[model samples]
Target: MKAIFLVPKDYKLTGGMYMPINHYVDYFNRNGMIVDEIIELPYHKDNTCKGISERLHSKLSEEKYNIVGFTLNICYMMLRDFQLHKNSNCDCTCFLVDSMSLNMDSVIRNESIGKEYIEHILKFFLYELKEKYCLRNCNKIVYVSSVDKQYVLKRFNRDILGDVFVVPNGIDLPNEVSDKLVRNENDIPTLGTLTGFSQETLNNNLYPFLYSIFPQIIKEFPDIRFVIAGRGASVEVEEKLSHLDNVDYIGEVEDLHDFYDKVDIVVTTVKKDCGLINRVLEAWAYRRLNIGFSKNFAAFEYAENGVHYLSADNEGEFVSAVEYAIKYPDKARIIRDNGYDLVKNKYSWGKSGEVFLDIIENK
Candidate 1:
C-alpha cells in the first residue's frame, strides 16, 4: 500500500492544514504504506492560470502514486490530469480546508469590498460548479468540521454523501502545562488573541471583535494585558485601540509556542465564519483558559461551557467571562486543567492518524 499528499506551496510544518497532513504521512508510514512523499505544487504567482496549470499537469504525469490527497485551492488542471491518468488502483481524496461556500458568502455580503455584485455572483457560481465536480469525482472528501460536511451534502444533489467524512484537527500535547502555570504566577493575567487583520479591508474576522468587544473588556479590566498576535492590523484598528495603555501588539509570530507560553488566557473572538478553531485547541494543549462563543467549540464535541473552556455569546458575556477568570483564579485553573485533559485524551495525533488511515483505506 502507498499514499502521497499533494499539498499547496504555502503548507508549513506549523499549524493549519500541515498538522493533519503531517499526521497522515506518519500514519501511512507506520501502517505498512510505502508512500510518504508529499509533493508541494506551487501556487499561482504569475496571475496567469494557464501557465500554472501546464506546470501542474507536467508534474502530475511524473509521479507514480497510489493514493493522492489534494489540499485547499488545488489547481483545476492538476485534478483534471489526475482524473485522466487515474488507474483502478489509484485513489483521489480532497480535504476541504474550510467551507468554501460560506467563505464566498462572506465575501459577497462584505460591504467593505469593491467588487461588483454580478462579478461576485459569477465567481461564486463557478466556484460551486468546480467544487461540486471535484467532490463528485473524488473517492473521499474530508471536512475539518461536521457543519461543513453537512453543508456540502445539502448544497450538492450528487450521491456523494456517503463519501464525505469529518476529521477534526489534531495537536501535539505536552506532558504538562508548566509554561502556562509559570505565566499564571505573574501578578497581571494576560489575554491573547491571534488574527491576520490588514489595513486594506475590514473583512478580517477579527475586526468586529477587536473593534467592538475588546475595548469594553479593556475598560472593565484596566490592569489586564491584551496581547495581539499575527500580522495585518489595520491602521484604523490600531488607532481605535491605541488609547488603551495595556495593549501589546506583537506582530507576526513564527510559532505560537512562545506566544501561548506567556499568555494566561486565550481569547477567541466571534467571527462570521465557523470551522475548526486551531487556537482553541492550542490553548487547551497549553493548559490555558480559552474563552469564545459556543460556535467556536462546535468542532470539539467534548468541550463543555465553563468546564473544558468558557463560552461568551455577546460583548457583555465576553466581558464577564474575562472578569470571572481574572477575579477567581481557582475556577480558571479548573477550566484550563479540564481542557488539557480533554485534548490529551481525545485530540492526539496518534488517534487522528488512525482515523485518517481508516478513512483513506476505506476501512
Candidate 2:
C-alpha cells in the first residue's frame, strides 16, 4: 500500500510530536508500505501559509499514495488539516493522529479544578464540539497512548473519522542488556538527561539547578558522570553548564545509540507536562532505569515509584531518587532488565507498526 504522511516541520524541540512522526515514517516504510513524507513548514523563510496552502492544494490523488494521512499534534494544526480534508478529491482514507484528547484537557489547570473542568469540557466536546466537526472528518483516528484512547471511547461514541485505534509510541529495543557484571566495566552508575529547555520553558531553572547538584552527586560517587543531550538549551544554559567539569553536553544527537550506551540510568526532572516523555521510552528501549518528577506525570501507567521508574515528587525526593539510583547498583541493573523487557513487549515500534498496519489495511 502507498501512504503519504502530512506532518508539520516541527523542529526537534517538540519531542512528543516529532519522535512519533519520525517513528511512523520509518516504521511503515519498513513494513511493506510505500511511505512518502510531506511536511507543512511552520512559517519558514521560503514558505508562508499561502505557499503551504497552494502546496497542499496541488498534491491530490496525483501521487502514487493510496492513503492520505494527516499526522500532527495540537489544535492549531487542525485548522489547516480541516481545510485539507475539506478540499481533497482523493479516494484515499483520511487518517488522523490525535494521541491525546486535545479538546477538553486543560494545559494550564492544576489537578483539582483541571479534573472538574476537564470532565465537563471533555464530555461536552465529545458530544458537541469534536463529534460535530473534528472526529467526523476521518476514516480512522490513531492515538499514541492508551489514556488518550480510553478518554475518547468511554466519553464519546463519537466515531472518529477513521476506525479509532491506539498505537502507543514505540521503542527500537536492543536484543539484550549486558549482564549486570559487565555494566560496571563500561560505565558505573552514570546518569543522563536530555533537556530541550530554551528560554521559553525554563527562564532560569532546569539546567542551572541540575549543574549545581551534579557536583554534590560527584562528591559522593566521584566516578558517576552526566550526559546532557538536546538542541534548544539557551545560550545561557550552554554557558553555565559548560563550566561544570562533570557535565558532558552533547548537542543534537540524531541517533540515541551512543547516548544510551554510556549511561546506566536516565533522568527526566521535568517540572511540567505528561503523556509519555520520549526520553523515558529511550531509557526503556536501552534497558536503563529512569528518574522523573511526579507532578502532572499521572498520565503514565508504567512509571511506578520503584519498579520501572524512580519518581521524585519534590526537590528532596529528586535528590533521594538520584541517591538511591546511584547507591544500589544491582537494583539499577535489575530495573534495566525489567524496563527493557517491558518496552520490547508492550512499547516497541514493531508492536505499534503491526497494530497500525492492520488498522490502515482495515484487517
| CA lDDT, every model vs. true structure | 0.69, 0.59
Give lDDT tens digits, candidate 2, residues 22-116.
77677778878767545545522243666655665566535543444444332224333435555555334433444334323433242345455
- Poorly placed runs, candidate 1 (over 4 Å): 13-15, 44-65, 75-78, 84-86, 106-123, 159-162, 179-188, 198-202, 231-244, 254-257, 270-272
Overlapping backbone residue pairs in candidate 2 total 7
By lDDT, who's the top model here?
1
Q: For model 1, what is the C-alpha lDDT against the true structure?
A: 0.69
Best-matching candidate per TM-score? 1
What TM-score, computed on C-alpha atoms, does each candidate reach? 0.82, 0.68
> What tens-digit string does per-residue lDDT give for candidate 1 at 184-244?
3324578887766653234445656667787788788777788877766667767766765
